[model samples]
Target chain A: MNAGQQTTRRLVSRTGPSICRSCLDTLSRQPYSTAAAAAIQTEPQEALPITPPTPSPSYALHAGILVSRPPLLTRPPHPFESAYHLYQKRLNERLALPFTRYFYIKKNTPGDLEWKRKIKQRLTPARDIGRYRGYGDEAWNDEVLVGAQESEMAWQVERLLEDAERDGGEEEGKKGEGVQTVGGPKKLEREPVERPMPRVTEADEKGDVRSLGRLLQRSLYLVVKNKEGEWVFPQDRLIGKESLHNAAERVLVQSGGYNMNTWVVGNVPVGHYQHDFVPEHLAKSANPTELGLKTFFMKVRIMAGQADLKSNKLGLTDFKWLAKEEVQKTVDEKYWRSIKNMLAER
Target chain B: MALRELPSRAASAVLHNSRPAVLALRPSGRRNASSEALRDVESSSSFEVPFVSDSLVKAFDPIERSKRRRLGKKPLPPSRYQFRPPKYYRGPLHPHQPPPSSDPVSREFIPGPFASPRLEQTYQSTIASDLMTLTYHHLPPGYRAPVQLQRLREWTGDSPYFKGRPLRPPRGGGGLRLLDPPRNFKNIPEITKVVVHSMVPEAQDNSAHLHVAGMIVQAITNVRAVTHKARHNVVGWGLREGKYVSVTADVEREDTFHFLSKLIDVVLPRIKEWKGVAGTTGDSSGNITFGLTPDVVAMFPEIEVNYDSYPPKMIPGCHITIQTTATNDRDARFLLQSVGLPFYGKLVD
Candidate 1:
């Protein structure tokens, strides 16, 4: 074996078995159930129809149509398979929103409608499936998340089913003296306990939310402070990349919209190291009140081209904030106690 | 814009590389008479008044160069348009038929818009050359220079708030009562009036350290006057002669606040006629002097002056010092002068 392999083996041998405790527990319980579960997910394997069913007369004119079925996209092989591939390629190109000139769909067939109704019936309680979904995967990937995998027809049916279930649950709870929490239970705590959970939306998978979130994060709210105090606004922070998606649903709303934003000016970026004397000098030279209130601004050019943005490229100019409330909160007693013991060792 | 008007006087001055002191003495006005007529204004060599010709002024624009290129021939009399010196003076209009003016400044420089007869009539009395010079230098100062402009915001919005509370009264009272109080200096008077001055190296090459040392000597000596005035009005006796002193550390950077504090404490009590400086207006030189006793400097370990060093030294004292490595002497001069320094015999007045 290679030296690296030998070293890894030796380490494993010294540490005992390499199997994860949880994985081992899963394996010991039964491997068959997981396989059966995987096999039971039949929605993805079913090929789309040559033409999607047209909407029923009622749906066709429905002004409240929250969901609409797109036309069936086919990639079928043919006698002239190569030509068919080329045609498929052209059709795929037409699928692009920017270049597509027209789009039409045949809606509403009975069999498809039944499948939608069945999928809709399965959704309940809106449980967080983010951890199981995997990063960058849409919240509603067909094989990944059942709650998000339902078709448009199924979605409407699902909403009706959920309303019925909620009403039924409330009635049952009323019989049992009036208390039924949505996601199981909650514990009483003094300070509001904020649980960071990823929220998956049906629109995120095979829909526009993820892409739209990316555009907004890059263009507008590029610089932001996270829980770790790092100034970064990844699209992942908006739509989420990993299975832990829907940061906006959790932290953003919980934080009461007090999020700070930044803009670049001059050569000085925000958070660039500055001495106390800068304020004194500005107070003497520029407007003293601005200096005292920390309102001096600078404009600077980005040193790196925008192309390297995917590689964590930083511009020459940076925007730093000395946000008053945030800084005060940072030095507060409770916040200090939270990190003090461990930081003291460092 | 006309060729003659296209290049700013600053650019011409830069091209000519005239010394600032020399240029300060000259009076260069603008040109006059709109170029639309191509018929008005006389070109006379008799008086070297140097009013730019309407034709010569038309050629200097960068945008016009593209138009001249499209015409398949270079414009004649390129000297006025280019940065080079003119070999000869031509007539009022160039030999070639001048193209129509599409320049932005051409219309703006004149009183009225293009093709208007009133344009020439309105501006005929004033020379155009003077107006160009006026516009060039009249750019708003502070973060608006070509180099710094890119970084400035479109607008700073509003003026910063200033706290205009009356400055604290000078610590010691003036005249006899301040120096020898009715109860004989009962309350140790606070040294309030501090006079801060800066010292520069006689030569540009002098070490910043040595220069600051010299400045400290001067500031201390000058401060002595304020101190003497505070206590007993002893003319110049606050410092007993022959005690030479120097600061080991260079504090040229902190002189303003540091000296101000020192004046409030150390130098005030030693003055004989120690009345506070609140009601006092102009000193003999019309410049205010502040004094602090050495005791205050004793409170701060940063200062090196000794209160017990009774007799002040004969060594030349120091003032605040500024060090710069930039090419712009004007920027360097402005930088120091902005920090409350007296420049070109201009006082705070």
Candidate 2:
């Protein structure tokens, strides 16, 4: 019967394996099981499909947040990519049009003299654009721009400025200065100082999991260690009748504290992870009706602040803002496989 | 930032260029040279710009010199070897074939739409991936989609005309529905170009209204507005046949980005009570159109900066058409919504 069950399981596994297979059978049967099924399945498989399949095992729905900080800095290209680009640059340079210096620059003016004085007359045959110089015959050994992974936090600043401009417009309009006064939108022109934050933070150096400062060049997802000593995204069981998105909002606050400002990307769940409850754990809890857990992941972007695990009522043991690879390493193989697709590659 | 990245994308085309021109790849290229050189000497280190003083710029007049050069000289004759593309496309077998578009001198060669905008960047980085995941249909490995009936139906009951007739289109009126291909990573909806069109009815009576409209449109869009002739008389809108009724600027390439960013960032916010673009804006096909009133048009920074230059009443309202690669309105709406343009009222997706 056990071997028969395994074979039958393999047969109907495509419908919905494990706990939900029975309910899936009822759904599929109503729609009429395909001719393809009859072509593939044997007589023995058909007998077990009918009986003891309508019990309708209930699974608790969970709303989980994969709160992530998008890559703060664009990643530097690999050595090969940079080299290919360098080659392309040199190729473009070699097959280029002649520069009409006579037209653009006058013969003996200060600007013209400065152009002659400042221009580095290299032995290379090609007239170059910008500073990727190919000195002499070794022009093939060109070095392309290696965009350093530095955090200017320009996006954050731009967002703040945009928000300010938007919010301030109404007040300015009320003052009769916005549209009326030629003062024109109050320009906040700050001379951009090179106050770049170090790409590698102190948290990174100390290997501190609690800090969000580490990993500037990759998407850092929030993974919390629950009471079960398992690393998972911030998750909790859904309360009665709340929508999936709202449940996600409530779940995050319930598990983690209210210190962080988060923007949930959309109302719908990105993906879901399902696991059959362990028989032993189910026995201990004495829950005959409960079969498994299904977590619907809501993608939330953490704009500012930190997850305060200490003050949280749900009692999460620890938390880490780790990149994709680190996330895979921290979570179980099954859990990793399910949620990995939803997370950003970098 | 876009100005710095412009040159590298000169070879690329009007498409989804999310990687942000080749300048981002190199360290030296990444340095903000133009800004440092042009703005001030103290702001930058070591590198010195040539003395670009007011006197130097004032003295170095290209227009005056060009005027001087052409003062007495007759126009130069057209070069003997200069190639003009065939007026008609001869067969491929013909000896005097037209050059491919890739050729630099080809009339069809359009070098730009370079430097994909920041909005495209936002789409590529975040919105696109989010959309793909949300719309993903996970069919467990070998699960086959059930066979479905074709939308178009065959003619029945043997009418003589029906014998050789092609399959009739779906039962709806002669409206042809766009093919909604299943969403995947590769075929993500992308913004193509923006068309800024303005109707100047007063232009028929006096040409100044048309010129002012064209100038304002050109200033805001960074693309020269082309005057469009009315095909026939429309008495209601004051349009007459052969009359210069409207001017339109097709904002493609870098201008699309610039125009969109300027519209969203500068102008849209300044509006006192913008309820947003109408929800039923998009045609069933990909393109979405929204209109900006003359009052709203006044809010554009380019016009606002030089408010005294134009007559206040002459500013013409324009319809902005956002063309996207998506085949349907829903996808186009999603793309625009993700880029922070809200759509209010009954969204008919």
Candidate 3:
């Protein structure tokens, strides 16, 4: 026999010890038996061609009692597990840390004033009254005298001039006699004046007037009034599992209707404020929980999309770009004091 | 008598002023002549009338003269003075006064009973509120919205702003397009090493048990297993320092891949009751460790075929640690998954 046939015969003898020479001879007589046909039918269509007939009598023994079968059974299907399971397991096994909330205290730009002006003009025109006043004709009129007695002295000089012109010859003769009586030669000599009087031009005669006073502008803080009518800055809670800066940006988008891609958010917090109280919505719920809410206020500059303030889902009832004084009047005293410096002009 | 002397004083002033005028009228006159004439006129004055010339006044009081000059030549009203508002006045004045409340008061101030419900409904019906409801109600609980899903919503014009900009097509005619091949495969995963470890109890410190465990690891991994001594004493468990407590084998490169494939395809399935590896088996450094029973370890063809070579003693369970070239457990798990290993839990953020 060839090496391949000899090796197969040895493996078959080792695998199926119970199969007799007569059974093997009978199987050789009919290489394709009813049992083989049944096995082929039961096997998967693609696997049938790849799998050679089993050397053991497991398939043939079921049809004829010429050989015994081994006790080993076929293996079950094993499917590959998913990666999501590992992620969840790791998450559950992780240690918990304390919750932190971050808030953004955004700065208003010069365009904010223009926005406020436009809003005021459209919604409430009365509030658009100018914040400036002209100093009036009195401030503009620059003809005030330096001293109270200077005007009277000037008038007396003018009168003296008129009298001198009327009686020139007689007055000159008297003045000459008086001059001869009191140290004549020394009195005749004159010294140069130390200072000269400034001449007045036509422009000076008209007056050195000042222009009108400038408008008194004030810095506007972005304030929002909740459904309960309490005025507060645009803020929201920071959910767990995110960096403070990222949470702050999300809060701006979710609560302030800010677009993150368009807005330039500051990496560090400008200031921080904390308070212990239950939120209005939470307080109204069946279970009220008081929380020590800490907020790290970051600064954000809006680059686009300011007109859609009404698009925020937080249910704020009113929004106003108010000055520091106005915001103080509207919000709680303690809350205002905590964030007063942040709202001040930088 | 002093009143009678006033006429002589006026005449001397006029004569002094006239000499300068005559000097000014004659352009050709030498400066020395005018200066001499001025000195003579000043010396001739006998009556000392308290009247100071403008030049003398300027010399003595320059600041006052400049102030008057800046104020212009016209005489000013006596009553003019700098205005200073009273310290107590806090309210606005003139242009600063609050604008007349021309706009109607907001209906929010009125009692809820008197307010219009229709107006309130219209106010509440915003796109953001709708989106919030959709996200909360439509999506599965704890399911993070994937980036692609969010981008899909934005591209479909569901977002109020399209990618934070107004929803407008480019001037050149192209519209928003989806990113090609949704997955980013820049971070490819690779198998780093495979470690097989078996812990033997101190009570079972017999050489036969240790030898059998080492042989099993060596046979399955085709690598030599190293026996590790216990570092600390555990009185309750009867473990002592310097005792052989464990045997471990590390397989790398081609061997790691071969061992992993063999374990997944041949050994793992043969276990009587297998439910895949635990998801929490991985460490932070992307190495995943799992345990297999002695029966499962024996199921390896290497151990199964030559069952008689080793003594038929109870074999100890062993742990298989698969390390990957990944930064974290998530990426390691993904790599393992790609290589046909199954994991069982949801990924957290």
Best by DockQ: 2
Candidate 2 per-residue lDDT over residues A228-344, each given as its tens digit: 899999888878877777987887787667888988766667878998978887887766678898998988888899998877666688898899889989999999989988888
Correct interface contacts retained, every candidate: 0.00, 0.05, 0.00
Candidate 3 local lDDT, A212-312, one digit each (tens): 01111223345667667887766666555455457656656655564323332334354566766546755775434434556666554433333134677
Model 3, span B1-349: residue lDDT tens: 9999999999999988778666667755445632657655466544234666666654654445567786957766767664433334347654423323331122111111211122122212221122222222222233333344332222454765556664445446345442322112233334678899999873245767888888788878867699998888899877888888889999864457567778887877676656677777776666788888777887888778666566676577899898865556765676566456777665421
Write the number of the candidate with greater DockQ, choosing between 2 and 3: 2
Q: Report, for every candidate in turn, its global Cα lDDT versus the true structure.
A: 0.30, 0.71, 0.50
Model 3 chain B weakest 10-residue run by lDDT: B107-116
For model 1, what fraction of the real interface contacts is kept?
A: 0.00
lDDT of 3: 0.50
Instruction: Write model 1 residue lDDT over B201-270, tens digit each, in one string.
Output: 2222333433443434443432212111122223343322322222322323223335433543444444
Ten-residue stretch with the least lDDT total in model 2 chain B: B40-49
DockQ score for model 3, please?
0.01
For model 1, state the Cα shift of residue B82 in Å.
68
CA shift at A36, candidate 1, in angstroms? Answer: 84
Candidate 3 local lDDT, residue B109:
19
TM-score of candidate 2 on Cα atoms, chains taken together: 0.61
Best-first order by lDDT: 2, 3, 1
